[model samples]
Target: HSRGSRALNDGRDVVLMDADDFFISENLCSHISMHRDASEDGSKVKSTFFVKFYQKLHAEGWNLTLISRKPEKLRNATIEHLMAEGCGSWSSLIMRLDNQTQMDSQQLFLRQRTVLQKRGFKIIATISSQMEAIPVPC
Candidate 1:
């Protein structure tokens, strides 16, 4: 079994999706303007502004959850980068396993939504770059 699968089976929490689907940028403007080059791997990209935003959300009592398709090998690096970027901790780091590499963002979101809801979280909103994939209420 792959390290990614082993990590998922360890039982913290896992959300399935492709790695390319995730994105992070320095700021909202840059995020919108340079969406093509954004990378969610924190070790590769450092965003102080985004970190502050995440901290602000946490201060406001929002439980920030990171759902990514990153593998086990990158978990510590991602965590370290997040800490260096000023994020103290997060509510969860839901990752995708090796077998789940083919899952789409929508399915990932839905499954994790259900999991969070069952755990007594009231999801206020979902922020994603792929608007087409996520369902919206008319």
Candidate 2:
């Protein structure tokens, strides 16, 4: 429904992210984790949460035009085939779950995201909290 009410706080635009998966922090773009082995806990983490969120959008008549640094042009059928063949990377396997512009670089991703914003997609930029968090003594 509401992309969690947004506000023009400080200089950058921010929005409250969907609960259960996303983690919004000072940085606007940061989800990639060093612990590659960590599980999403079935969408408990940020990236998986965003992917699931977008999947819902796809079902709701939203035409997604993703602009990724790593651009792959293939149909869902191909992805399925790859999975069936058991030959796919973690990134490829994950990206196959939806139709999105999967990129590698933040700059490129942001550039494309800006263009999409101009084109009108109603997208929000959210990052995980701990990524850029200033640890306060507990």
Candidate 3:
């Protein structure tokens, strides 16, 4: 049986693999398309609406937090992109999905919300591309 099958069946086998192995190769057409979409230039253009919204929220004394499914390898790139889009203040609030946190977007959002609530911050709003990430009745 495959290691993955064994792990699933009995939880006894330990599988080791590099995180990079799961990412698409740079040469693949899909990877290229995704790279273009995530590029700094593309981000600057696509982020205009959100940037304006965030600026408005900031003006209204609301602190924004970013929760992303991006891997840790792209953390610096994410930060630089945020800074370029005039969101430097939010760089410190970025929460990225890394290898250790193997939770879905909804779980991650709930975890982050709990943590933030403990810090005395009332989470009045959440902006997410994925509707599943936002709990109903929130």
Measured by lDDT, the strongest candidate is: 1
* lDDT (C-alpha, whole model) for all candidates: 0.52, 0.35, 0.48
Error of 2 at 9 (Å): 30
All candidates: CA RMSD (Å): 11.5, 12.5, 16.3
Q: Which residue pairs come into collision in candidate 3?
A: none
Tens-digit lDDT string for candidate 3 (62-138): 44566655656677765666565576554134344565367775676677666666765555556643565566665
* lDDT (Cα, tens digit) per residue for candidate 1, span 95-135: 66676668775676677667887886665545443553355
lDDT of 3 at 91: 18
Per-residue C-alpha lDDT of model 2 across residues 1-138, encoded as one tens digit per residue:
425433333322322122212322212222334434434333335544565554554344343333222224444433443234232222111121234444334434444445545754444443222222111233
Tell me the deviation in Å of residue 15 in model 2. 14
Candidate 1: residue 137 Cα off by (Å): 4.2
lDDT computed for candidate 3: 0.48
Query: How high is the lDDT of residue 10 in model 1?
Result: 30
TM accuracy, model 1: 0.58
Shift of residue 117 alpha carbon in model 1, Å: 1.3
